[model samples]
Target: MKHLASNLYYLRTRNGYTQEELANHLFLTHQTISNHETGKTEPDFSIIQKYADFYHISAEDLLLNDLSKKEKNSRIIFDSVIFDKRDKVFIIISGTKGTYSYKNIKKCEILNEKARYKGKEEPFTHQVVTGVDWLVQANILEQPFYVGLRLTMKDGTHLAIYTSKQPTRTQTDFHIRDVKEAEKIKELIDKIIMKYKNDESYKMDNVNSKNIFFDKDRQTFQILSGSKGIYPMKDVCKCQIVFEDAKYYGKTKPFSHRLLISSFESFFVTLRDTYVGLEIELKNKEKLYVYVSNIKQKHHSDAFKADVKVAETLKKYFKTIITGNKTMKDE
Candidate 1:
């Protein structure tokens, strides 16, 4: 295995940074940086974080084993094996999803037809399927498709196969089918967006009461209760708007919704300039709210104002907004 220390040394050297220069940037001693690069010592977690932050790279990339030379050498050998038994195996697997059964069928029937159609001689070796089955059952090979299989050789060479007379047809068929299906899904999504835009329940009865609206067609869940004004189903993160003219927004990353809720909590503490309690409801169920005491002080009010300013700064990054209050439940 290629060593990470060597890779780190190479990266630092390629960047033209001396050990002392790197150490100064990471807040470490020059000796420590040298030791890490020479494999004499490993850096601690804190130091690792500093190194990652300095490089703007994920820690996993820095810590993983280096295989650059080995990969290059293997690729050259695998490429030159013009009529190797493994090449035929790759041809069979690449035509189908990585599945042992499908590969067997293709090698027996499909391979002959493909060879004749292409005017190429029959591949010299064909019994490699037994070896492939053994490798798969031993857990050395990962099966990624029911009709296709991805084979990873011991040397790290990889091949894929799909089970079709015209293997390339699989991708084309999938794309055409997806386009047809998306049209149907889009119709249902449009209804949801319409509901949210028309829903009366989402309208603010009292600005103090927090509310959440769900648009099923659009697959959007919107929360509208605060001075920041109508935040569209897409803006909040829990949901997204896929169709351009839908009633409710659609759902995307759930973590973004949680992040928005956290932002709201911060908004309540800072922007409203009041210590009054705030409650959050999802799907008509009371989920979360916060109560803060000591609303009388000028400093406390200023803190709330500061919180709003912070929220406004962050708000620039998110642009989607809720335009109308239509409820999905009603539709």
Candidate 2:
């Protein structure tokens, strides 16, 4: 076999180190270093690794002369480390999440595909397939980066490749409206009630429920529910009236609704003002509106104007509104 003794001798001389000095640095006997330089004996792998580290050269370079065809093939094994199927996909996960979350796909793609061959195919898919194939050919599924592939193909159909295991979840923190925003909503509700007070045509029942819709961008609120059911502030007083079907009211009798505000920071109110009995629904914990009487009332233009004004006043204070049955958190 060829030997690297000449190359070793050259490197030692080039670095201004004698045989004894090189031996001392490598923790080998001076005679062993002399034998290595003269090609009398080959050094063990541990010594070769140490020599590579000491000279800042690769083991492959130091042992290149001594490597036979079989040895050369062995070097190929080191070209790429074998990884499992699961490990291959784990690499793909980095680029996907980085692209989606940070909007940094350009950087991620460049870094990830550096060692990969250039092609027109999707860069991530190519990296994944290459990794998988490398693992499979080397029979290294048990290795740390190993992954399995189930591929299907037939005439006149696109190929299908399936991967196992879901990607890991990425955690993120988001800011939410604070208690101050909640207080602002409450203040807006109060203003709407005050603005519509004492209008006979307004149909303010003993149980009056108010729904506040919040405009987050504008930092304001709008009233959503009323005797006419649900109406926007802009249409509250105009000729544009969108009537709500009286489904909450039962058939054939007078109904009375009751509003119940709970101490748990939630609201419940019931709608019962037609043929149905008293049914309750929650408006808000601090405030609620319920229809308490079955008195039939007519809609007046002035009353409509008053309702619109109340909604307009409230619109300056709240953000996003939801109306539905309320349930206590612990309950």
Candidate 3:
């Protein structure tokens, strides 16, 4: 046992392997390697052979030889195997093939296959860490392109990795092993990015009122009670946008259309199904719901509808704010 333990540590360090790298090489966990090196656990005979093979030596030689003699003279090898894995920031990005780490990535760039840009031309670029918003893996209907995963920044910058192509199939390859894994990776990355957004303190000019707007103009369309005031887009948080049936089961209430902001209580937006809206939660736990009205439509007789111009104006403002502040905090 002592011989095996000592040899494990000696061989690992002699090969210049971190616990993680060693685990990857042996198809084992880091904790497993740590345990073996510390003499806290033992590997089966099969695992012994695997490690022996990885080191390009016979199992008998590995178990019998006194490795200390070689350890004294052996030089550590810091080869590309360990460095290659370390260099990547993401093991997978939004359900894609390659691992992308933030290590040396200067910026995220967008690519359009259908665009008639000049040869070898790419679209906009955003800083890899701070400028990226959350990782997105969604399917858009009737679109010529299939974006496997997208990184949308707070400022509306986007970087998308294309999904696998199935010429006969109309949809993107959502079932690929790597694509599925990338979806899970996207969730993890988003949670991490959201953590940074939540950590930072962003103050709103006023939290007393929840106003809904449509276009870029700062117009107040609909205002809810108990709000501090209308907060700018940067102060918004993740919110649930719910669209209810106007006449579900049978007749419905006047304000059947609703938008729920989790961060704010007693505050929501009443909108027609076609209305545009924005919901945000700030670091301080305040929530806002903004509804941009449809110019062509009107609210039910009993319900109130925001002004058409106001709706369009607020909509534009929210879109800009959401895009500009997609992921405000640094990665």
Q: Where does candidate 1 stray beyond 4 Å?
A: 65-331
How many residue pairs clash in each candidate at the backbone level?
Answer: 39, 34, 36
lDDT of all the models against the reference?
Answer: 0.35, 0.33, 0.43
Model with the higher lDDT, candidate 1 or 3: 3
User: Can you tell me which runs of candidate 2 are displaced by over 4 Å?
Assistant: 65-331
Q: Estimate each model's TM-score.
A: 0.24, 0.20, 0.23
Number of the top candidate by lDDT?
Answer: 3
Cα lDDT of model 3 by residue, 1-331, tens digit: 4478889887676544678977986789999999988889989999999988776556876787777674333321111111121111333222222323332232332332321221133422211221122122122222232224455545554444543332111223433433454355355456545433442233222221334322122212234421325454445445533223233312333224553323343322233333334445564786654443322232332222344334344444444444434532322
Candidate order (TM-score): 1, 3, 2
TM-score of 3: 0.23
Q: Which residue segments of model 3 deviate by more than 4 Å?
A: 71-331
Q: What is the C-alpha RMSD of each candidate to the true structure, in Å?
A: 20.8, 29.4, 21.7
lDDT ranking from best candidate downward = 3, 1, 2
Return the lDDT, model 2, position 71: 31
